[model samples]
Target: MKKGTRTSRLTVFVVTVVAIFAMIGIFAQDVAKNTTLGLDLQGGFEIVYQISPLQEGKDLPAMSAVAESVSKRINVLGVSEPQILIEGNDRIRVQLAGVKDQEEARRVISSTANLTFRDVNDNLLSDASIIKEGGASLGYENGAPVVSLKIADQAKFAEITQKVSEMGTGNNIMIVWLDYEDGDSYVKEAAVAQAGGEAKYISAAQVKSAISGDCVISGGFTESEARELAELINSGSLPVKMTEIYSNVVSADYGIGAFNKTATAGIVGVALVMVFMLVVYRFAGVIADVMLALYIFAVFAIYGGMGGVFTLPGIAALVLGVGMTVDANIITFERIKDELYAGRSVQNAVKEGQSTSFATIFDAQFTTLLAALIMYIFGTGAVKGFATMLMVTVFCTMVLNVYVSRFLVNQIVKSGALDNKKTWFGVKQSNIPDVAKRQEQFYFGPFKKVDFVGKAKYFITTSLIILAAAVVMICVNGFGGKGALNLGIDFSSGTKITVTSNETLNTNEVRSDFEALGYKPSRVQASGDKVVYVTLNQALEQDQLTSIKETLTAKYGIEPNDNVVTPVVGRELVKNAIALSLLAWVAMLIYITIRFKWDYAVSCIVALVHDVAIVLAIFAIFRMEINIELISVILAIIGYSINNSIVVFDRVRESVVESRKPKLTNADYKQIVNDSLDKTLVRSVFSSITTLLPIIALLLMGSGAIVTFNFAMFIGLIAGTFSSIFIAPQMWYTIRTHVKPKEKKKKKVKKEKLDELTIPGIND
Candidate 1:
C-alpha cells in the first residue's frame, strides 16, 4: 500500500462525491420548478374511456385501430403525460395525471374521435347542422353529406334518415322532438322530422340497419331532427363498453392517515436499526451508527437530487435497506474481534479488520448493485423508480457505512484515544491460536473433493433443462407476447377507484349492487373495513354513470364518492418498458465486463436472467397480473442476487492469494466459497426477513395491485438467496475448472493474470 498517496486518494474521492452532490442539488431545485406534477398530490381529472369491440363479421381490426386513433385524438388535447391504454379485449383507459378540471378533461375525451364517410364517388361533403354543435365533419357517405354527431344514441339517425328519404312529396305529418330544460326531465317539444321524400333517398329498412352501427339520415327532416341526426352520425361508439367498476376518492383525511402511518413505520425502522447496531458493537457500533445517520442523509440527498418520486414501494426498499445498513459493519466488527482474540494489538487488529472486510463488503454491495441494475432496466413506473432509488442509496450506504464509519473508528483506535482494550466496546483480550501463522493445514472433516469436471455433462444438461423449461413456459402462456402476465388496469385498460367516507358502510353491498348493474367489478377489497377498493373490467361510459350511481346509492344508503382515475396502456408505453428492461441488463453487463473479467460479467448477468425468469415463471404459473408494482420487487431481487455472487467471488479471490496448498484444485478451493456463504448466510437471511415484513403488511393490508408487486419481490428475494448461495459459487467453481493449469515455465506469466483475477484483500 502506498502510504504517502493514500491521503491524496481519500481526499480526491471525498471531493468528487461532494461535487456530485452539489451538481445534483442544483438540478433538483430546477426540476422542482419545471417538472410535471403527478395526479396523486394534486387534484386531477380522471378520464375513463371505453374500447369499442369488433362487430361480428365486420372487416375492422377490432380494438387495435380504435386504440391507435384514440391515442392520437387524446394527444391532440395537449394532456401531457396522459396514460392512454387498451385494456383487456374491449377497453381503453385515458388517465390525465394532474388535470384539475373534470369538465375540461371530459370535454376533450367525450368528443367523437372522428367519423369519416366515403361517398360512392369518393368525394367529401359537409353538413352545417352537426358542425354547429361542436361536431366535426368526418367525410361523405353514399353521395350525401355525413357529419360527426355527439348524440347519446341513434334517435337522431332515425329522424334524419327518414326525412332525407321524404324530400319532394312532403306531407304535413311533422314529427315533434324535445330537448330537456336544465335540471328538468321534460323536453320542450319541436318539429324534427316530416314524412315523404323522393325514392332516391335511403329506404326505411336500410336506414335502420346502418343506424345500428352509425346514425342514418332521411329527406324532408326539420331543423331539429336533421341537427340531431347529424350529431348521432358523427359521434362514434367507444372502442370498448365500460362501467366505473372501481373508484375511491381519497379524502384529505384518509391521505393524512396513510401518510402518518407510513412515516411512523419508517422512523421506527430506522431507530431500531440504529439502536441495535450501537448496542451490539459498543464503541465501534457508535461509529457505524454515525455512518448510518450519514447514509440516511445521503439517501435523501440523492433521491431529491435525482427528482426521484417517493412511491410506496420505494419507501419499502429504503426501510429494508436501512435494516441491512449495518451488514458491512457487522462483518468488519466480527473480523476485528477474531484478530484481537489472536493476541494482536488493537491498532494492528483494526488495520487487519479493515483490510479483511473490504472484499466481503465490496462483494456484498456489488451483488446488490447488479440486481438493482437489472430491475431498473426491465421494470416500469414505480418499480424503476424503486430500483433507481435503491441502487443510489446502496452506493451511498456502502460509502458511508463502510469507509467513513471505518475511518472514524480506526483513527480513534490508532490515536490511543481508546487506550484500554476493555473500554473498546468491553472487548477483553483473549488467547487464541493464530490460524494464519500455523504450519498445519486445517480441513473440514469428511468432505470429499468431488471432481466437477467428471460431472460437467450432467451439470450442463440440468442447467439447460431448467433454462429451457422457463423459456417454454413463458412462450406457451403468451407471457413473452400479447398478454403473458395478467397486466393490471394500470398497464392495460380498466378503471381503478378508491372511495372513503367518515361514515362506516358495507363495502361488499356497494360492490355487489354495482356488479349487478353490469359495472364489471373486478375486485372489491376492504382496507380496514371502512375503505373499499373497486376495480372495473373497463372504463365507465357516460350512459352507465346514472345507473352506477343509483346502484351504489341504493346499496350503501349514500352516494358513492367517485374519485376516478383511469389509466390506459398504449403499445408504445409497453414497448418502452420492455426496451428499458432489456437495456438495463445489457448496460449492467457491459459495465460488469469492463470492471471484472468478461466471463465473470456474463456469468453474473446469466444468473440475473435466471432470477428474472424464475420470478416471471412464478407469475405465469400462478396467473399473477403484471403491473408497474411487480417491477419494483423484481429490481430488489436483482440487487439481492448480485450481492450474494459478489460475496462468494470476494472469498474466492482471497483464497487465490493466501492458499499455499500444492494440490489446490478448484475442488480443493471450494471451502473458500463455503466459508463466504457461511459467513453471509446469517446477514442474508436477516435482511430478507426484514424486507419481507413490510411486503407482508402490504399483502394483507395494502392496495390490490400493489400486492402482486410485493409478491414478485417476495418470490424473487427467496429465489435470489437460493441462487446466490447454491448456484453462483458453483458457477465460479465450474468456470475455474475450465482454466487449465500452466506449464512450469509459464507459471510466472500465469501468476500475473491470476493476480488480475484476484482483487487483493477484498474479501478480508
Candidate 2:
C-alpha cells in the first residue's frame, strides 16, 4: 500500500470509531428520557376486557366507539399517558401506569354510566339521549352537592318534563337512575324532600312545569361522589359490556428493583462477552467490540425513535442482542482467519472472507428477521415489545455488525498494520499451509476428523425416540385430567397471586389458607424465601382480589401481586400463538427455498420443527408453566435454529459450487456435506456458545420474572445447535442422494445408418 493511502485508511478507521461513539453520546440521554416504559417496568395496572353486546342477538358495538368510551373514562382517572388498545374483534386492553388509586381506576373503567330518567310509574321518559356530551358538572343546589346536566336537545327535555308535569300531584315525580339493571329502582334522597324508598340513584324530583334547557339532579351525595357522577355523566355510557378478562398490577418498588438487578446483570454479562472476544481474536476482536457497542446504541436510538415502550423482556432482548450481534462478527472473523490459514495475504484474506461470509450472514439474519415479524404480528403487551426489540437488533446486526465491522477490519488490514503477521488476526504462522497445497479436505480447526454424516442415523433415531416419548407423555397428561402441558394463567382462565412476606412463608400454609377461603389453588410454590405463588382455576372479582390481598397482608405481612385472565382471552391467545408459529414456518420455508434449494429449505424447516418440539417436550415433561412468554421463546428458538441451519447450508452450497462438478455422485455429495460441516463446526459451536452465555447469565442471575423465559431459550439454544449440526444436514443429504441424474445419449448410431442407406438417391 502507498504511504498516503495507508494514512487515509488509518484515518478512516479512527474517524468511524469516534463518529459512532459521539453519536451515541449525543442521543443517549434524549433516548432514555423520551422512551416509554411498559406497565411491568413502570408501576401500574393493565386490564384486558372482552366487550359484549348488551342486548342478545344484537350486533356487537363498534370497537372504535368502545375504545373512545374507555379512553374518556380513563382520562377521568387522571392517568398520564394511558394506553387503550383494541385487541382482536371484541376485546380492549387498557393500561394505566403510575396511577395512585388502582382500585378506583378499575371501578371507574368498568362502570357502565347508563343514565336514565323514569316517571312515578317507573316508565322510562328519557336517558342519556338528551344530555350533551361533556356538559355534566358538579354544582351546589340549596347547600347540597348536586350533579348538573345540560340538555343537548331542548325539545326532548321539554317533552319529558311535560309528561312528568301532567301526572297527579303526588305522582308527578321524575326519577333518575345510573346503570339501572333488573330489579333496580330509583330511591328518594334523604336530604331532598321526596317520597320513595332508598335505592342507588341520583335523585327523585317533582316537576311543577315543563323544563327546557338545563336540569339539576341533586341527592344526598358527598362532594367526591357528586364529582364522580358528573364525570361519568360527561363521559357517557359504554355501548357494550366490558368483562375484565385479564389484569395485572405491579408495584413501583418491585419494578425499580427488577430494573436495577437486570441492568446490572446485563452490564456484567456484556463485559464478559467483550473480554472473551478480545482474548480469542486480538485486533479483529477489538473491531467487533466496537461494532457491538454501536449495534446496541443503534437499537436503542431506533427503539426510541419508533416510540417503543421499554419492558423487562425488552431489556432481556437488548442484552441478548449484544451477545447475538457478536456472532456475526465471529463468523466473519473466523472466515478471514480461515483464508489466512489457506496462505492468503491479509488484504486478500479480508476481501475474500467478507465476500464469502456475506451470504451466510444474510441468510442467518433474514431467518431471524422473519421470526420477529411473526412475533410482532401475534404477540401482545410485553411479548410484542420483545418482538420489536428483536427485529431492531436483527436489522442492526446485519447493517452495523456485518457491513460496518467488515469495513473497519478491512481498513485496518489495508492500512498495512496487519501485514506479515497472522497472529493479530488470530491465525498462527505455523498453521498456514502452502498456497498450492491447499485442499478441500482441510479443516479450519480441531474436530476435522469427526464424521457428522456417518452418525446421522444415530442422531435421528435418538431424536425420534425422545419425540415419541414426549408425545406419549403429553397424551397421558391430556387424558389424565391435568393437561397436555402446565398452562399458566395467561393461557388458562384463572387468577395468579404472587405474595412476598417479610419472613419466609410455608407453601403448605399458603395453600391451606387459600383452600380455607373456598378456593382450591391449582398450584402453590415458593420463590426464594419471601415469595409465594398461588394459582386458582377461576377468575377473581375485584372484591375477591381485595379480600385476598387483605388476608395475605394481615397473615404474611406483605401485599401480593395479582393477575387474572378469562377463558375467552386465553383461548384467543393460544389460537393466535399457533397461527403465528405456522405462519413463521411457511414464511421461512419460502425464504430458504428462494435463497438456497428446496431440499435444503425442507431440511431446515424440519430441523426447526424438531427444535420446537423438543423444547415443548422438555416443558411438558418438567411440567413448566407454559405462558405467553414461553410462546415468545419458542418463536425465538425457531428463528435461532434456522440461523444455524442457514450458516451450515450456506457453507455446503459454496463448497458444491466450488467443486465445479458436472454431476455430483452420492460419494461426492457425502464428502461435500461432511467437509462443509467439519469446516463450519467450530464457527457454529462458538456462535452458539457466545449466544448462550448471556441467556445462561440471565437464567442464573437475572430477575425471577424472566426466569422461565431464559430457561426456555437456554433449552432452545441447545436443541437448535444439535438439530443444525446433526439433523438438518443429514436430512438434506438423504433427500439429495435419492434423486437420479439423466444420462447423456451417444451419437455413433448415425454413421451405421448412413452406410446402410448409401444406395438411396440422397447419398449420391
Candidate 3:
C-alpha cells in the first residue's frame, strides 16, 4: 500500500471513532429525556379486564370498542399517554402511570354510564339516545348541581316531551335514570333521591311544554357526583361488562428505587464487558468496544424513537445486549485468529474471517430474533416490553458489531501499521504454522487435546439422569397436591401483596404473621431493605383485601400495594407460553435446515431441548416460581444454544469441504468432528463467560423483581455452552453416519470424474 493511502485510511478511522462517540453522546441524552417508563419502573397501576357480553348469546368483537371506552375513562383520571391493549377475544389491559387516586380511577373505569329517560309509569322513553357523544357537562340548574346534556336528536326528544305533557294531570312527568337497575320501583328510588341508588333517579320533572335541544336534570346531586356523572356520560357507555380479573399497583418509591438499582447494575455489567473485550482482543477488542458503545446508543435511540416504554425487564434486555454484542465479536475474532494461525496474511485473514463468520452470525441472530418475535406475539405487559427490546438488541448487534466493526477493522488492516505485530491481533508469532505445512488443526487454549466427542455418552447420560429427576419431582409435586411446580401469580390465580415497612423485615417473621392470620401464603420473600412480597393462592374479596391492607398498614406503618390475577388469565398465559416455545423451536429448526442442512437442524433442536430441560430441572429442584419471565429465559436459552451449535457446525462443514482425501473412514470422520470442536471450544467458553458476567451482576445487584429471571439465564448459559460443545455436534455426527453415508461418497466420486473429463473440445 502507498504511504499516502495508509495515512488517509488511518485518518478516516480516527474521524469515524470521534463521530460515532459524539453521536452516541447526543442520542443518550435524548433517550433519557424522551423515553417513557412502564408501570413497573414508574409509579402506576395496571388492570386486566375480562369483557363479557352484557346479555346472554351476545358475542363481543375482541374488545376493541371496549378498550376505546376504557381509554377515554382513564384519560378522565388525568393520566397522560396511558397504555390500553386489546388482548385476545374478550380481554383488555389498561396501564395508567402516575395515578394518585387508585380508587377513583378504578371507579371511573368500571362505571356503566347507561343514561335513560323514563315516564311516571316507569316506562322507558330513551336510553343513551337523547345525549350527544362527549357533550355532557356539570353545570348549575337554578343554583343546584345538575348534569346538562346536549341532545343528539332534538326532534325526537321534543316528541317524547310532548307526549309526556299530554298525559293526565297527575302523570304529566318525565324521569331521568342513570344506570337503572332491575327490581327497583320509583317508590324505593324516590326514598333514595338525595344520595342516589342502584337505579339513580336523577329527576322527575312535570313537563308543561315541549323541550328540545339541550336540557338539564337536577335531583339533589352534589358537585362531585354531578361531575362524575357528566364525565361518565361524556366518555360513552361500554358495550360489554368489564370484570377486573388482574391488577397491579406500584408505589412511586418502589418504582424509583427499582429503576435506580437496575440502571446501576446495567452500567456495571456493561463496563465489565467493555474492559474484558479490550483486554482479550487488544486492537480488535478496542474496535469492538467502540461498536458496543454505538450498539447501546442504537438500542436506546431506536427504542425511544419507536415510543417504547422502558421497564425493569427492558433494562435487563439492554444489559443483556452488551453480552450478545461480545458474543458476535468473539465469533468474528476467533475466526480471524484461526486464519492467522493458518499462516494467512493479516489483510487476507480479516477479509476471509468476516466472510466465513457471516453465516453463523446471521443464523444465530435470526433464531434469537425468532424467539423475540414469538414473545412479542404471545407475551403481555413487561414481558412484551422485554421482547421488543430484545428484537431491537439483535438488530443493532448485527448492524454495529458485525458490519460496522468489520468495516472499521478492515480499514486498520489496510493501513498496514500492524503488519508484523500480530500480537495486536492477539496472536503470537510462534503460534503461526508454516504456510506449506498448514493443517486444519488449531489449539483452543488448554482444551486442544480434550476429546469432546469420545465423552459424548457420559454427558448425554448425565443430562438424562438430571432430566429424569426433574420429571419425577414435578410428578411428585403434582400428585402430592403441591401443584406441578411453584407457580407464581402470573401463572396461577392468586393475589400478590407487596408491603413496604419503615425498616427491613424478616421473611420468616412475615410468613409466620400471615400463617397466624390463617392465611397460608404460597410464597413470601423480603426484597431489598424494606419490602416484603407475599403471594396467596386465593383471590381476596374487596373487604378481605381492605382488611389485609389495613392490618399490614397498622403493623408495618405503611400501606401495602396489591396485585391480583384470576385463574382465567393465568391459564391463558400458560397456554401462550407453551405455544410460543413450540413455535420458536420449529422456526429455528426450519431456519437452520435452510441455512445449513437438516442434520444440523435436528441436532441443534436436540441441544436446545437439552439446555431448556436442564434449566427447568434446576428450577423444579429449587421450587422457583415459574412465571412469564421464566418463559423469556427459556427462549433466550434456545437462541444461545443454537448460536454455539452453529459455530461448531460451521467449522465442521468447513473441515469436510476442505479435506484432501476422496473418501473418509469412520476414524477420519471422528477426527474431523473432534478437530472442529477443539477449534470452537475456546470461543464457546469465552462467549459464555462474557455473557454470564452481566447476568451475574443482575442477579446480585439488580432489581429483586427480575433476580429469578437472571438466575435462570445464568444457568441456561452454562447448560447451552455444554450442549453445544458435547451434544449437538455428536448428535449431528451420529445422524449423518447412519443416514446415506455411501450415497454421499458416490456423489463425490461422480463429481470428481466429471471435473476430470471437462469436455475435450473446449480445452483443445
**lDDT by residue (tens digit), candidate 1, 703-745:** 4324566678767777666666556666666666676433122
Q: Write the per-residue lDDT of candidate 3 for residues 1-764, one digit (tens) a residue.
A: 68999999999889899999888776677777878888777788899888887777987755667877888888778788799988878778888877877788888898777778888778899988677877789999788899888898999999999999999786888888766666656766666754555445767888988897789887678998888888888888776777899998887777877788888888888888889888889998899889888988888889988988888788888887788878899999998898777667677788878988888888888888998888898778777888899999999989888888988997789998776567787777677754444343244445667777798889889988988988999999999999888889888888999988879898988888788777998888777778888999997765677777778778988667788888888898888888888998999988888777788889999999899989989989778888778888887787666889988998887777767687776677788889898888888988987888888888888888788889999989989999998899889889767773332222232221111211334521
| Residue 241 displacement (Å), model 1 | 22
Which pairs of residues collide in model 3?
none
For TM-score, candidate 1 versus 2, the one ahead is: 2
TM-score of candidate 2 to 2 decimals: 0.90
- Give the alpha-carbon lDDT of every model: 0.54, 0.82, 0.82
- Model 1: CA > 4 A from native: 1-101, 105-254, 305-308, 334-338, 341-343, 356-380, 417-487, 499-508, 522-528, 541-581, 593-599, 606-610, 613-625, 661-663, 686-705, 737-764
Worst window of 10 by summed lDDT in candidate 2: 750-759
The model with the greater TM-score, 1 or 3, is 3
